[model samples]
Target: MSEPKHVVIIGSGLGGASAAAALRERGYSGDVLVLGSESHRPYELPPLSKGVLLGDAEEPDWVREADFYADKNIDLRLGTTAVRIELGGRLVHDGSGGEYRYDRLLLATGSQPRSLPVPGTDLPGVRTLRTLDDSLALRSAFSAAERIVIVGAGWIGTEVAAAARKHGAEVTVVDQIQAPLEPVLGAEVAGVFRDLHTEHGVGWRLGAGVAEFAGGPDGVRSVKLTDGTELPADLVLVAVGAAPRVELAHAAGLDLSDDGGVCVDATLRTASPDVYAVGDIAAQFHPRYGKRLRVEHWANAKYQGEHVAGNLLGEHEPYLSSPYFFSDQYDLGCEYRGLADPDNDELVVRGDLKSREFTAFWVRDGKVTAAMNVNSWDDGDALQSLVDNRTEVTPTQLREADLAGLG
Candidate 1:
């Protein structure tokens, strides 16, 4: 296809903003229009559950400066929603009846936090943290709340528990799984988080699920568990998981994965010509994993956005970066590189888990498949190199910490 005369991007999160900046950086002088549903400009969401909720950070860390769009002649429309995509005519219609014609289109609609279908979920005190406004409201709620009940033990839930405890609120986290974050970090590593929260005075109710929530005139008053135990709660946060926003893509008759995300090829191109999807909404084919995976990390969004922009400009390259993400809870900071099968692979630990300073590597077929460093710094580059290069090493070499500089 010839160079696009006008490109319209839907959603204004990190992926959308990065793609716009990347296009400009790569010398694409076409008309760029970004449609955002939120009123604020593009900003990072990771801090919402951590520093922002704890009152440590007050400003939104924008992906780009406020004047970046105007300075680059990029048309940015905030507080507007893309309601429909007319692929036949290559046009997009917003909620306000505004129609935009485009030669190329990008979808970075991201995802929305999943909510509980149980009763009292719509109570006044119930909340879910996703955007900056949600975080600010949660911070204020935690300030006045004496007791806080979190419904999920995932990353966001654990982080919120830490912030709530820091603010003197009695925090209780409940989950159906035996260990929190077991699905991602596995049982052994997830135990570290469970211990950290317990030591900090955070309560946990594992192997249990919420039956219902009872509320009074003000809001939620208590939570009833499946085991028939009722726990009092002044506030409630449901952090189960997120569902990708694929309504627009589905409406356009685009191919979707069984999990509801847009299915894209290795180049981040959807089945439709001149159209692509990135960020949490795109389940792109991953060569390393040998399967299509949808990653929700901030780094993945930024990297994929830049790569998609380059591909649109004729720099054909497969999206081949390994998955990476990090989490911060209290004084514990960790970075994970690469993907590994939790059921398979041998996990080797270096350093002391008791001291909370350790690096864990997953070895499969004598190759380092993944590595994670907790409470450590300045070793991500080396760790990532090992995963990317698929360096072969024995169990002794990994456990003895002698694979340094091997990458």
Candidate 2:
């Protein structure tokens, strides 16, 4: 089969921009069109919620400027939204009713923030942090809000709380779980977060779900919890989670998994040969874990973008970059490497939680399974390689030996 001559990537986020760069780097003399939904050029989103809100981060470039696309011979379309897909004809229809035929199509639409599913969610003071505009408006509201209620204890919720606290907004994190971040980080270890927030003067409402948002003319007056307690608040942030953008794929009859990602094999190819999905839209098979993984981290999008670009240009390489994710908030920064099951045994947690520097390794049945480190990148890199390589390490040795390097 001959290499595809035209590659059209939908969504100009980290994933789409990196894919275009990878395609040209691989010596693929093809037409690359990058379409972005936002009016701004492909810009980074991490800072919008965290660094930019904290006043420590400047507004940086998203990926490349508009002129950079011209320098790279890439076609850049900003403020354009892809509405639907026609698999048989291999065309992407835009919101404005424009159509473009492509030899291979990449769906990098990414994800949207999940909202609190309860009454008064439509209230004026209620907000969800996802896009640049969302963060900007939320930042403006923070200056006036006396008490801010943050629903969910995930990273985004915690990060926004940290920023709001920095802005002198009294913030409270309401979580249904026993502890903050227990769903992902495990309850035993996530205690650090509970203590971290409580000690920092951020209020906590545990074992509770939202009943409704009670509005009193100006804005939200208070948040009603499931425990029959009403917390006083002027602003609320719903950071429950994110849902992948899969409506276009679903409408086109592409197979979608329960997690809302388009199911694809290692090569990032769907059942329809001409259509390839990547970034947040693609749920790819992982041979390492022997399970299908749908990752939503920043790195996943960038790596999968490159892989789909190569696969489109006849390279046929698999998308396997070792799933990793990280979070920075308050006084803590964490980086995760490799995949780990929460049910796995033989977890080695080192360092002191009281002083906050620590690293943990997940070993399963005598092999390194997954690892997480807080401000401990060196140890994380070593353990991650072991997990990725399936290195064998006994519990006794992992506990006793210093993990500076396995070199």
Candidate 3:
């Protein structure tokens, strides 16, 4: 067995930390270095826009703390970035004029906020909530703002809506899709969210895209909708989506997708031999389903990171992750298991969409491939498993039978 020398992990998000933790769990005592782009310590990121933004969660609760990483003996580098990756020479260039040498490199740089190329996009009062600093800045602004207009009806937008509403700011969400989270949950489930926000005194503008930004002396004043309506606003949030930060890898002679994301095989291995990609940046090829997927979700990143770490420590295990995502919009919790592709055929499941507490299964042909839920379970205990076990349940039976069997 080859003695593991040094493993360099970029981006100390949940994925990167999970990768390092998994390595330790499997009993690998080599050098593990975690490179974090953010200045803050390693932390959980889900509550940045939700619980933390609403003041129900604290910074101490979010971060894993400095001593934890020290106890683990993982070299945690804060305010550092691995922008240049050299596999042949086994070197990485940091943003702070330093270089790192590694036996194996893990690219967990995650994704970046997708920006809107509008007139007042660079304006002062406008921001997108992705990081802890972004949420803190927006929270400070929320104390004085009367109204906020969210430009996209995605998960981030919905979460921000909940956060702003908690802070007494009148929120309005505008999007091209008819409902919030249209791309992930499909029309049936997204419609539930569409009504969910509206019932809470929030405004919704469906089938409307931002035409242009109108700036004022104070900051951004109003947004010109494509339908010719000028919606007045004190703040604007461009919460459309995220693009993977793979330019450094792509420019360094690595094979990347047309979308500028790292291409990985079943084992999370890129074209480069010693370098592997994980998290939101690695576009993975699904061995079970025969499709290439680039999922920007918490679960995918954590699981993939662990898989790559296991493989790095002489496991040689194949990486196989069931595509999954979850969202906490208002009081309703939404989750999806397997690959919920709307492009596939029929959908059969149990759900009272109006009530907003049920599960829906997506079926293609006669086999059940995917399942989505509102406040569902994540127990893969024996055969009654959920996410990983994609059981074929019929529409009538699913609508009637107790889905708590998933527990």
Instruction: Compare candidates 1 and 3 on TM-score and give the better one.
Output: 1
What's each prediction's clash count?
0, 1, 0
Q: Which candidate has the top score in TM-score?
A: 1
Runs in model 3 lying further than 4 Å from the true structure: 60-63, 376-387, 402-407
Model 2 agreement with the true structure over 257-307: per-residue lDDT tens digits = 878899998888888887787877788987777778898877888778767
> For model 1, how does the per-residue alpha-carbon lDDT over 1-407 read when each residue is reduced to its tens digit?
67888989999999999999999998999999999999999998888987888899996688999999999998999999999999999999999999999988999999999988788888889889899999999999988999899999998999999999999999999999988898877788889999999999999999989989899779999989998888899999999999999999998999999888999999898999789999999999888778899999888899998889887766557899998888889999999988877668788888888899999888899898889999987677888888998988877776665455677
The runs of at least 3 residues in candidate 1 whose Cα sits more than 4 Å from the true structure, single-residue gaps closed, are: none
How would you encode candidate 3's per-residue C-alpha lDDT over 1-407 as one tens digit per residue?
Answer: 26468999988988898898888777889999999988887666677877778877766244355677888888999888777877788999998789999988888888889987767788778788778888788888888889899988888888889888888998999999977877766887777888888888889988988888788667988888989999888998998889998877886788887666799888888888778888889887877688677888888888898788877765566677677767776788866777666656466646577778677776675445667777654422311254356655566656666555632
Q: How many backbone clashes does candidate 3 have?
A: 0
Please, what is the whole-model Cα lDDT of each candidate in the order they appear?
Answer: 0.90, 0.82, 0.79
**Cα displacement (Å) at residue 263, model 2:** 0.4
Q: What TM-score would each prediction reach against the true structure?
A: 0.98, 0.96, 0.93
Per-candidate RMSD, Å: 1.1, 1.6, 2.3
